[model samples]
Target: MTVKQLSMPDLVDACVQLDIGHVGLWREPVRAYGLEATAKLVRDAGLTVTTLCRGGFLTAIDPAERAGALADNRRAIDEAATLGTDTLVLVSGGLPPGSKDLRGARERIADALAELGPYAERHGVRLAIEPLHPMYAADRCVVSTLTQALDLAERFPAHQVGVTVDTYHLWWDDQAPPQIARAGAAGRIHIFQLADWTTPLPEGVLDGRGQIGDGSIDMREWKGYVEAAGYTGPIEVELFNEGLWARDGREVLAETARRFVRHVIA
Candidate 1:
């Protein structure tokens, strides 16, 4: 959510003005604006909904908690189908309360996927499992590498489940490139996202993603990796920086587009 500060209508207008034909939407804003209405808004603007951000967090030791997670994901799937986007990026959950079992936690995610994957497929959607950085392992996601994500995704059909190759999280791993190739060979690289890692991460590391070209990542290099892997889908720029948010949303959107051209496209 690079321009999370912008209202849905304003964001839509910005995209149209900037000739941004496709958008990756987050669930909160879409739900707040009314799902059907958002679907109509984007549809009427002739903008494609690229992918729905997040329908995971399946790790839970408690039975009721696990059921709630699955139910929420089902709603997310329905929302994705309603929004006409086939990809649902998942941030599989972390360890449950007082639990130190990482392996057990991941297994729960697989169990949830087994139930959710077919439901998603029935709605013309695919579940894209996104592995967060290892730093997020304890409380955000246990799948912290492309290899781990692929291990989970391979259990299901490629069309029903796949992995999200996000530069922000995977850039640190030397093994990611080969994993990208592996994912591509199986047609499981569902979506590719770009975000730069900046130094001196803020207290809230979640919002520390930097603007393209403003950090250490070679955006074009990562782009090349995904392309070499035969991922021809939309390349989404998803930043989470509070600094950018404090600035003008429209201006940030325009700037991000320019940065994409400079750092990724060129």
Candidate 2:
């Protein structure tokens, strides 16, 4: 949660100095710290950049805006390549202002991918489409379900485009297990993230993610499902909780590791 007041140097120090092994990076912080420097830092620390936070916002209605998103995503792909991570998480932008054309927005995402997919392939990067909770369908991600993500991902080469499985977003869906298996079978499961689901979602519902096992999500079950789907990559513990953010970053990192083992692994 570097976006929640933590600096990149501190975040990197916490991971490397603390022997955390891996980290997921956001674009802004990477840019702010100088992308090459940050990449060198991580590499020198022997840390793995499991996935870059995001790339796609390809759901705009205006042709010009959509083009801009593509350009931005292209830059994101280049940055990811520089960071030495192949997976670039994609939070496809939500509906255009005052627009209810969900279908149109999704279609735009498909179209944009058609253009960016080849570019990503050339750079040896994969765009992992993250299906945010349906709650964000109108404002954050038009792709609301794993099935929908797969639907779009299947349209492109598996290596160039794929789907992200984040417990925080897909834990409540009844079809998640099957969809995960499907993604794995297709070789389209790019990254796996962990964040528990909790009540009293914060305003805008963006930063209320629960620490692992602190809420209702059955993380062990999902972990099993994900592993069963042949996903053996790093399981990123990504929490967006205000309380956690308000605490010492080291403490939060420690607790996240403990919970990940106790709830997600043990």
Candidate 3:
């Protein structure tokens, strides 16, 4: 959500003005704006919904909690289908409360996927399991590497489940390149996203994603990796920086598009 500050209508206008044909949408804004209305808005603008931001967090020890998570993901899948997006990015959840069992937690995610994957397929959507950085391992996500994400996704059919290659999280791992190829070979590279890592991470680290070309990542290099892996899909720039959000959103959207061209496409 690089331009989360923008209202849906304003964001749509910005994308159209910038000639950005495909837009990746997060569930919160779409739900808030009324899902059908948003679907219509983007459809009317002739903009493709690239992928839906999230539909995971399936790690829970309690049965009720686990059931609720699956239900929520089902709703997310329905929303993604309604939005006409084929991909649903998943941030697989972290450890259960007071639980030190990382392996147990991950297995639970697989269990949830076993049920959700087929359901998603029936709804004409695919689940893209996104591994967060290891730093988020304890609380936000346990799938902290592409290898780990692949291990989980491989249990299901490629058309039903895959992995999300997000540079912000995977850029630190040298093993990621090979994993990208592995994912591509199986036709499981569902979506690729770009975000840079800056020094002196912000207070809560979650919103610390740097703007493209403003940090250490070689945007072009990562783009090359995904391309080499045969991922011919929309490349989304998803920044979470509060600094960018504090500024005008339209300006931020325009600036991000320019940065994408200069740093990644040029």
Candidate 4:
């Protein structure tokens, strides 16, 4: 589960009480709780750390800014290593402020990955470039498609750099199926998250995620595609909707469990 709406302890408790085998954690809560403490907590509970939420945003024009981003990612890599998870999700930063050079932004990502790839390998961590939907291309994430994520990942060994497949971000992409197969073949499909798409998006479009099977996307097809591509990892249910987060976290977790079986695993 993402740590955006719950304290780390609450998150861990809910997961344990529900017998959740794996969880995806964000960096902020992990830091706030004391990295070692949080890691130990999850370890003692016997839950697998699925993937660290993020470690990218490396697309910057300013040299200092770029350097700072790389340094931060190094720390993130160290954190993932400490947490006993090899996958560190990377959301390549969006366009530089007031700039329209999308190509330049993508190129900068390649450069940054060239530098950070070795660092991640040394830490025994794999960097997964998560391409946000095209809607987030300007403000949140520049890598906007699975193909693009794979392209960046292909530049490095699969073990060092990989890609994340989030159904919410990729359901609209017609090209995603072939790329998913390719990612699996190359051993670069590091993490898979499920979030259904819904309309009437909230402002900023960041927190409008829907629950599984509640939207238009065919989740069974998504699961079939990924499985056909040879991905047999934990399928994380990630929701960012404000409405959902406002409800009881345990209720949300219970419903998520129901939907995962009904819609994703069926």
Q: Looking at candidate 1, what is the lDDT of residue 98?
A: 97
Q: What would the per-residue lDDT of candidate 1 be over residues 19-132, giving only the tens digit for each residue?
A: 999999999999999999999999999999999998898999889998999999999999999999999999999888899999999999999999999999999999999999
Q: CA shift at 2, candidate 1, in angstroms?
A: 0.5
TM-score of each: 0.99, 0.97, 0.99, 0.97
List the pairs of residues colliding in candidate 2: none
For model 4, how does the per-residue alpha-carbon lDDT over 26-46 read when each residue is reduced to its tens digit? 888899999999999999989
The models' CA-based lDDT, in order, is: 0.95, 0.88, 0.95, 0.89
Candidate 4 wrong stretches, greater than 4 Å = 1-3
Which 10-residue window of candidate 2 scores lowest in summed lDDT? 1-10
Please give the lDDT score for candidate 3: 0.95
Error of 1 at 172 (Å): 0.5
The superposed Cα distance between candidate 2 and the true structure at residue 105, in angstroms, equals 0.9
lDDT of 2 at 103: 94
Residue 116 error for model 3, in Å? Answer: 0.4
Error of 4 at 264 (Å): 1.0
